[model samples]
Target chain A: SQQGEEDPQALSIQEGENATMNCSYKTSINNLQWYRQNSGRGLVHLILIRSNEREKHSGRLRVTLDTSKKSSSLLITASRAADTASYFCATDEAGYSTLTFGKGTMLLVSP
Target chain B: GAGVSQSPSNKVTEKGKDVELRCDPISGHTALYWYRQRLGQGLEFLIYFQGNSAPDKSGLPSDRFSAERTGESVSTLTIQRTQQEDSAVYLCASSHRAASSYEQYFGPGTRLTVT
Candidate 1:
């Protein structure tokens, strides 16, 4: 079974708007990472936030991790049509390198 | 290639037949992993390889599913007596340092269809 679950399975937004997705996990984790998948393509790493950190930012991407609540959120600012893809959150528990992925959130950006 | 690559971008096979999926990790990468993503589902970890040590096969669903890697380079996933339920996109990934750097590079994946 998957450990993480993302809310709002699908989201549609216009270009230049901000997109936010949330993920919640069932167990404790060492770190959580976000990935973007293009249609029928491989996944690309976006950002990783460790358990000790509360928030992180990479360019237009912002990720927040709340270990106490076992939830995390990814925010993409100034979305573009090229940003339309499925986003997934993966968790790695302590001493466990194997990643447990969530169902994912499909984001569609319209021009 | 500069990134991970998988062979036979798409594969179609009949039920009860065996199929093999291959993955070629980036050069000098020590950790390799395999995952399966069914339609409308999350990616499931299948197996992992770290250098020359024993592989972690905890994620393999059954005995019929097995994977092997040679010298931290190429790896193969084999499924025996395939079933319709086994149809899914099989993905492979490799990390330069499994314990330290958590970044993993993924392959395009092989879309396997069992009839």
Candidate 2:
């Protein structure tokens, strides 16, 4: 399984604090993507970081990738209660079109 | 523009019965994908269609499961002789094009319960 594994299966943070989740993959990948799923809804794409790129930012979300370590981290700055959801890191393997997903980190941001 | 849409948001079937779940992708998206998520688990890639052609069906767990898409439009996933293990939320997503960089839009998903 080329599936990535996310550390800290669950995270609880205050509304004004930053929440960070880490993901580690087994094999080399072309790109890694982060997605958010609210309660029982579909996943919403958050950010994508390519292998060549070390870091990227969108709105209040910052993603960092380290190819040598095959690990990626997603940091949500000043999280809001609305940001409470399950966050998953998906990897697109070097030669595959399908994205392998990790178990995900269930984040709970209290307002 | 509408995002991907799926039918029968929830379903309940008895063991040994067949179930069909439907997915309607965003209008012109050329890539459609099917995934399954068991309770409290991550998404499991089942199959993907690139313009109606499924280049890889390797993620399918068994021969009892199958899916088909028609010309960048709708896709249906059928489970034959469904068992308790087949109970999961089936999710469908579509991308403007295949590969990296493009984000896939997902549907609400169909929740299946086999008893």
Candidate 3:
């Protein structure tokens, strides 16, 4: 079974707008990481937020984790058509090496 | 540095036939993993290999599915008697070390189709 579930299965936005996707998980985790997948391509690692961290940033991407709620969100600012892709959240259990992934959110940025 | 790589970008086989998928991890990475993804679903863990430790095969769905890694560098996943339901993208990922908090680098997966 999937340990995480993403909200708003799909999102569409104009190139310059900001897009946000949320994910909720069911178990305690050592960390949570986000990945992006272009259609038919490999997954690209995004940002990773440890259980002790609340927020992280990289370029135009921002991620937040709220352990109390077992939820996390990814924010893509000033989106571009090239930024369009499926985003997924994967949770790493405290004592395990395998990552459990969520159903992912598809973001489409229209130019 | 080059990232993870996998062979035979795509594969097609008739039901009941066997197929082999290969993965080459990034240099120096000690942790390797395999996962499966259906059309619009989340990734499903399949197997894991970390250094010299015994591999964790708990995620493999059946005895017909097995994977082997050669000293942390290359790994292969083989399925016997493929079934239509087994068709999906097989992804490989590698990390510098085996830990719950390490980030992983993924390879372009092999799309397998069982006819």
Candidate 4:
């Protein structure tokens, strides 16, 4: 069973536009991490936000975590056609080492 | 200096045949993990290993699946008498430490197909 669920299974936007994806989980977590995967390739870690933190930023990516709402969002600014990929959120529950991942949101950035 | 690496980028075998998938973690990385992803689905946790200590095999789906890591470097996942349901992309990942939270570096997974 997957612990996290991402909304908007697919999204499309023009290059240079911003894209946002949301994820919701059912259990309490110690930290949440986001990853990007190109077609038929392994995942690349984007950013990680701890439960105590409200927001985190890395490169052109911004992530927000709201423990109260059991949700998180990832924002990619100045998107490029190269940014077309699937995004996933993995959650590490409190007292657990294994991270559970969401189904993922597929983003298509057009040139 | 390289990231995690898995061998046999692709594998195809008939049903009831046993198969082995190998993964070599980055040098000095103590934590290694394996995941399975079916088409149109998210990655599913399969197993976790920290150094040569006991591995967390709770996520394995059945008794036919087993894994072994030697000297904290290369790891092997073996599926015995595989079934068609066992077909999936098997991914390997490694992390520096298991301090509760750390980013896992993934390898290009081995695509397994059981006929």
Candidate 5:
């Protein structure tokens, strides 16, 4: 399976602190995307980074991809209670739209 | 500018019964995908359709699971003789194309409960 595996299945942090989640996959990929799911419902896309790129940022979110290590990390700075959600990493192959997802990292930010 | 929509936000059925879930993707989108998510689990790919091309059913768990789409408009996922394990949140997503930087737009999802 090209599915990515996220470390620290669960995380807890204070509202003002930062939270970082890591993901490691098994194969080559075209791009990696991060998604957030609230209350186990639909997932909202957060950001995407191409394999050729090393890092990306969106607002308070920072994503880094190291293909040589087959790993990626998501860092949310100054997290808020509203930012608490299950974050997932999905890897897409070169030509296909299919994405193999990781068993997300559940995050909880205390207010 | 409507997003993907699914029907019967929730459903309850008995074991051994058949259930069909519907997904209406964003208009003009050419790529559609179906996923199943068990409680507290990541989304599992079920199938995907790209334009008029043959769908990729490799992710389907069993023969009991099958899906069909008509010209990238609407798609339906049917499960025969459903079991308790079939209970899950069935999600649908759509994109303008299969590859590249296009992000998939997801539907609210249909929650299936098999008693």
Candidate 6:
């Protein structure tokens, strides 16, 4: 069973605009991590928010977690063309070493 | 300080023929994982190897899929009697250690085309 499900199957926005994607999981998680894939290949780790954390930020990326709702969101401020890619949320269900990934949200940053 | 590496980058094999994909994780990383992505879908966890602790094979789809790791170094994912449905990008990732709090470094996936 998939643990995480990301909302907004796809998004299109012009450069300099902000994009937000949400993910909801079914199980309690140890941590939730966001990853980006370019050209449908390798995935680059973006940021991870532990169960105890409410929010986190790295560069242009911001993430917020709400355990009560079993959901999380990823916000990309000041988006750029290079940020066009598929973004996925992965969860470690109940402290499991393995991760379960959501279907992902495809973001298109048009310049 | 090289990142995770995978080979031969792309592979094409006939149905029923076996295939092998290799992954070399970052030096000293003790946790490695294998995943399969079909087209635009998300990653499907395949297998995981963490140090000497017995690997977690709960995610493998079937007996046709199997993986092995040598200590904390190289790992191999083998698919026997491949099917066209097996066509997908095989990705490998490694983290510094166990537990999900650590970030995982990924390799440039191997695109497999089973015809």
Count of residue pairs whose backbone atoms collide, per candidate:
0, 0, 0, 0, 0, 0
lDDT of 1 by residue, B9-113 (tens): 999999999999999999999999999999977899999999999999999999999999998789999999999999999999999867623888999999999
Q: Which stretches of candidate 3 lie over 4 Å from their true place?
A: none
User: Which residue pairs in candidate 2 collide?
Assistant: none
Off by over 4 Å in 5: none
Model 6 scores a TM of 0.98
- Candidate with better lDDT, 3 vs 4: 3
- Model 1: residues with Cα > 4 Å off, grouped in runs: none
- TM-score (0 to 1) of chain B, per candidate? 0.96, 0.97, 0.98, 0.97, 0.97, 0.98
Worst 10-residue lDDT window, candidate 4 chain A? A34-43
DockQ of all predictions against the true structure, Cα-based:
0.69, 0.79, 0.86, 0.74, 0.70, 0.89
Per-residue lDDT tens digits for candidate 3, residues B42-66, read 8999999999889999999999999
Best by DockQ: 6
> Per-residue alpha-carbon lDDT of model 6 for A5-86, expressed as tens digits?
9989999999999999999999889999999999999999999999999999999999999999999999999999999999
- Model 3 residue A29 lDDT score: 95
Q: Tell me each candidate's TM-score.
A: 0.97, 0.98, 0.98, 0.98, 0.97, 0.98
Q: In model 1 chain A, which range of ten residues has the least summed lDDT?
A: A92-101
**lDDT (C-alpha, whole model) for all candidates:** 0.92, 0.92, 0.93, 0.93, 0.92, 0.95
Worst 10 residues of 3 chain B by lDDT: B95-104
Report the candidate with higher TM-score, 2 versus 5.
Answer: 2
Where in model 4 is the C-alpha error above 4 Å?
none
Determine which window of 10 residues in candidate 6 chain B has minimal summed lDDT. B96-105
Better of 5 and 6 by TM-score: 6
**Residue B88: error of model 2 in Å?**
0.7
